[model samples]
Target: MLSGLQRDSFEYSIHNANPVNGLVRDKSRDGWPASIAAVGLALAAYPIGVERGLMTRDDAVKRTLTTLRFFATAPHGPEPDATGYKGFYYHFLDMHPGRRAWRCELSSVDTALLLAGMLAAAAWLRYDTADENEIRKLADALYRRTDWQWMQHGEATVSHGWTPEKGFLLYRWCGYDEALILYLLGLGSPTYPLPAESYRAWASTYRWKKIYGIEFLYAGPLFIHQLSHLWVDFRGIHDEFMRQHDLDYFENSRRATFVQQQYAIRNPREFEHYDELCWGITASDRPGPRTLLVDGIQRAFHDYIARGVPFVRRLQTKKEPTWRGGRGLTSR
Candidate 1:
């Protein structure tokens, strides 16, 4: 179930890359993290099934090995083709961009996530694909490249995946120790040293308890999922504080779901289909300026995916913008 977090993140990436709205531009290549996450989930989840005697360990091993090999050598192939892109290997085709650009990026995060998956696959299934060494190298790179600039405070309010700050949160409290270690040892992230401090800041940083509730969709699953289960101990402690404050898992998840609706983003399956499909930002129980910035992000990604590539051009002439929406009452 937690694996679905990365899956949803990838889906967001792919949907943004979709022809209906080409918002990601050349960055459409970033969809690889989802693909890798998918294969990894399959690889990791299947073993649990094997352990339960639902499938043979041999079958699980064969499947995992096949998947990893496929991921390492697939072609980018044609765009908007659901089959290849939807399939096991081709999904990650455009994942890496030659060199790092932004200090904090999906590049490093995805690399760490993918290599973490690979490492899990290696340890769990003991399967070594040709890309095993490559995976190790990528993991090493992820650890080597910890630009704190990528770390931000209170960013999970957005409808995307985890930020570095939240990444640290996942490390500290979620019950997933293996996944946390993946984010740490695999990426060589310096996050562990600051885990206690980072989590403390997050727990007490906000006066608005509602905002704390809003981050659950992204933060909760990022560490709790099979791919990243290293945050459990830290999450346990965090959970105690939340429970004391009445911010348990269910409540936080609800707020995050509400935020998603306001932003017009889809909810994870567990949030309830009737609520997800019919629920809109305009819905009564969900009425408010849900997450207005989410729409702005949507608009941006839509342009990137549709346009050939993004260019930050200087405007030939300055243009003024006008504001719209219900006006708020001014205070005396």
Candidate 2:
């Protein structure tokens, strides 16, 4: 099933990629704009396509080149319809022209995801061909051009995103979530690196909770525990917070996964079909915006939400200062 899904996902990119440019649509639905993060994932998937014998090396290289070239040359200004501004691309863009779409903010995390894909592609296709060399150069240019410090918005932590209409978003990236890749990318940049202290500032926002008697860094969504590790290896890495707790993120994620299963087994919420064999919830689509009375309880559901095992009292042994702002504590 996993392999089938993998092949399907790679095929989705191939089907959705704009032939004129390489931008992939965020969703398969009609009239949806391109998601930079989805583009990033698509960029990262090409090499896998080659390795899996789903695509030829030439084809993968050709596809990657198209994406890198377009972003490198695309108009990047404060204009309402530019591809990006200050090296950070908007969250959504037009499929053909690659202009900003849907009034989306210049997303720091999404751009980081895109850079991650660019760098990954550059690293994998390391042949001495001209196309491969240009890929490396363009990837570095996009990474360096990002003004990580400017995104701070005069604060220690990075802002969630920026809007041309209103400047920076009021909320900032804090605590631990999918932005783990975002912060690391900034910190690792050679030209516009975020300060080392910024990592500390971000780490300080972590919450240590003993969920199911397993103490680990507390973040509700399972994806939050996995996304960074997907692109960046953290198996043996120990950051400041990890050093303090004597636990690396990789190990913490493992614990979090176990806790997720345990949460399902316990079934505190009494969700039907939640058990040891059936569990694991992350952000997903929901048919909601309506209220229903279930088991004599009136509950409201929303269209889309990031779901996780509820953080219960049994999970807390002490208080940990959390720095996550902007998005709600759990269901963003």
Candidate 3:
């Protein structure tokens, strides 16, 4: 079952990709732009496609080359329609034009996701052939070109992203969230590595709380605990925070999942058809934002929101609390 799912997911990436530019569609919808992160993920998935006999190595090579070549040659400037600025891409790009889409900020987290995919491809496509060698070269060039320190914008913590319009985003990636890949990549970058203190600063913001007799680093969204795991093997590795806690991120993720499970088992909100067997709450699309009477309680519901458990300490009298537009509520 799991293998079939994996194969289907990979095929989605393959089929949705633009043939000429190699950009992958963000999602199947009306005129949705290509996502750089999706492109990066597609790059990484190509190797797995080869290993599983789902794709020919030559095909993977072609896809990788086309994608990397487009990115390497894409225009970079402060213009509103530029491909990117400072070597980081916008969250979305036009499918055909391959330029910035939606005028979105140059997303740090999405760019990290993309780079993770790129490095994965570079590591896998190891052959003496000219095309494979070019893949490695392009991957190295792209990674090195990313100015991590520049993205920091003179802050100890990395900014969430930047906009050509307003400059650095107000949000910094304080941890226990999906920004793990962003911080790790910035710290590990050879050309523009972040200071070790940056990681420390980010980790210091983590909140630890115990609920339902289970203690873990408190993050509302389940994906917060899982997104970083995609590129990172947290087992047997300890950051300063993990070392102090006597556990690593892998164990932390396990606890977070358990917390979600317990929350579902309790069904406090009385969401329709929620139980231990049917439990998963990620940032997802739904109807729209409004108040709803669920189980005779007035609950505020939202569309396309990152829903998670109520904040441990931050929640006062409110049933759900959103910190800086973080997340809210459970899902069915």
Error of 2 at 63 (Å): 0.9
Ranking by TM-score: 3, 2, 1
Winner of 1 and 3 under TM-score: 3
lDDT of all predictions, in order shown? 0.35, 0.83, 0.83
Which regions of candidate 1 deviate over 4 angstroms?
1-34, 49-55, 65-106, 115-195, 198-236, 239-251, 254-332
Instruction: Spell out the clash pairs found in candidate 2.
Output: 174-324, 175-324
Runs in model 3 with CA error above 4 Å? 291-299, 310-332
For candidate 2, the per-residue lDDT at 106 reads 94
- Residues 1-332, candidate 2: write the lDDT tens digits: 98998889789999988967899998898888899998999989899999999999999999999999999999999888899988899999988789988888999998988999999999998999999999999988888899999999888899988988999999888888888999889998888789988888888888777655678888887888987886877888998789989988899999989978987887765778999998887765665667788889876665555365552222322332122342223311
| Highest TM-score model number | 3
RMSD in order of candidates: 14.0, 4.0, 3.7
Instruction: Report the C-alpha lDDT of model 1 over 190-269, residue by residue, as the tens digit.
Output: 54222444433334432222221344323212122233442223333334356666555445445544544533333222
For model 1, what is the alpha-carbon lDDT of residue 252?
A: 48
